[model samples]
Target: MSHSIAPATISSPKDLIAYKVDNAEPVEFTSSKGYEERRIHSEIYKRHPHIHAVVHSHSEAVVPYAISVAPLRACYHMAGFLGADGAAVFDIAKHRDPAQGADMLVRNEQTGAALAKTFDNSNRVTLMRGHGFTVVADSIEVAVMWAIYTQKNAAIQTTAATLQSTYGGTGSDMPLSYLSSEESSVAREMTKRTVERPWQLWVREVESCGLYVNTA
Candidate 1:
């Protein structure tokens, strides 16, 4: 589980708490704050064995599209992992159990399973309505790549749409031309080979800022 205060850091293996798919509490340690949300990751891993890394982010740029009627599309070649059809938004309300009550968070196994089912083998990203988005990949680097580009894509698309609406009078309601399926497919393959490039850059930044210390 991750600490609510510092969501991005993993100082050591001690930061991780082992837990089963069915249980809400960590078997080895006392529960952390916001521990219930960890169910989302466990359920996703239970459903997709091939996915080794899962990243959930509350990016402001992507949240608008998730809450809006429009879906977030892959506006550029780097974001090809989002696919041509765009990412699907998962609505917790429809799947929530009224008896258990609703908090819009994946707090239990049932809600987590519902969230997991929203993802298919080919789907790499799923946006949570009024919440955030999750990305799954075979490796941590690829997952980070998808997560970063998803935010970038949303910002770029929003800016482009605003420009069109302001200057061209097309309105933001109109859909901008997105990448074609063929374009995305080929680009997705090509981009996988370059994931390490950005990962190295980010690692360097972390080191330079002294955000991560190597105890080993």
Candidate 2:
């Protein structure tokens, strides 16, 4: 994680090695929340007062299309919410000079602010070009589901594009089967009901596996 973000700028995220999940407090360290994670989360929380959680992920599946001209379409049945919310891309390459070699890192306050604008309008999803994506939701559970669905959509879109090209399709000729707005609404509501089960499972995993339990 430090390779992608400068540690000096981040207010020290309770040493990764020391963080445990047994519901015990830190013995010597003055542990705090994820500094940099809080940085972005703060912006989203402030911008959308109703939003309760923000999820950022560096999904490899979304990377290829982020850096390419091909768009991540609503290609999967389970990813219907993506189409309903409207997906968008945020290219730091376009936001900054090419010679600077942005390296897919939001290096400072200015960059972070620029990235936040990626959620310009109605989109709860935004693709960080050459980086990853950020998902905003009313709950952490929904945000988690959004991250998974985004990657799944990206993978499905990639496959769909590949199949179209292999069959001699060109440019706008690519095949697509996006759900209608009405269909997406129903699907989104149905999907929301299913998030509780997985979220509970994740909570169990966190306690059972000690996944960041040092500050518990």
Candidate 3:
């Protein structure tokens, strides 16, 4: 079948393939195929020309904020891309047809468009309620960084909030301090440029495992 590709089996550049954004038809003949998440990926690239890469991940630590009202703000400088207000929540239930029950998946064009719409001018991350989160960036490296640090921020935030509620004063009263808008802007610009450092480290680690090889 041409509708499935396993990441672990991929060894080099030839394992990768391209597809059209409009209909997701393969650009070249290959046994590999795109995943179901490609629906939102395609819609995002189609709607936002500036976004060169999109990463969707189900970081368990971040799922609490996605399903709750508590925002996932930047707990540290590295996650400044989350901004002061943090990631916007994209509820699949809002876009699902009444007849079709909520399965919490971007199953079609409507759900995909709804997900893409959540990425406003300031939104780099959108957390899908009861599902995973998506991060967008002008480059793949930056997107990977954002995805990694966003989950890290979530873990930190969750831990802090738990400790504060248990030991400190009221959790609501002692709200965790987050980066300001100005601070976030400055940190985002500064950290995005440093993505290559971590990218190289990650590439070396992956290559060491013998599961992947850099062809470039």
RMSD of each: 2.4, 7.2, 2.5
TM-score of each: 0.89, 0.71, 0.90
Q: Which digits, one per residue and each the tens of the lDDT, describe model 1 over residues 1-216?
A: 655547446676656667665554667655455466888888888988888888988899999998897779889999988888999889999887898766788888888888888787588899999899999888999999999999999999899888888878875566688999999888888778888888999988987876675553
User: How far does residue 144 in candidate 3 sit from its true spot (Å)?
Assistant: 0.5
Clashes of each: 0, 3, 0
Q: Give lDDT: candidate 2, residue 28.
A: 43
lDDT of 2 by residue, 17-96 (tens): 22111222233455343333344554555456677777888889988867787666566566766764357888776666
Worst window of 10 by summed lDDT in candidate 2: 17-26
What are the per-residue Cα lDDT tens digits for candidate 3 across 1-216? 115566566656676658788865677776555676677888888889889999988889889999897999988899989999888999888887777656787867788888989886859999989988999999989998899999999999999888888888774677788999999988999888799999999878887986665564
lDDT of each: 0.83, 0.65, 0.84
In model 1, what is the error at residue 190, expressed in angstroms? Answer: 1.9
Model 2: lDDT to the true structure: 0.65
Supply candidate 2's per-residue lDDT for 142. 88
| List of clashing residue pairs for candidate 1 | none
Q: Which of 1 and 2 is ahead in lDDT?
A: 1
lDDT of 1: 0.83
Off by over 4 Å in 2: 1-38, 84-86, 94-101, 171-174, 203-216
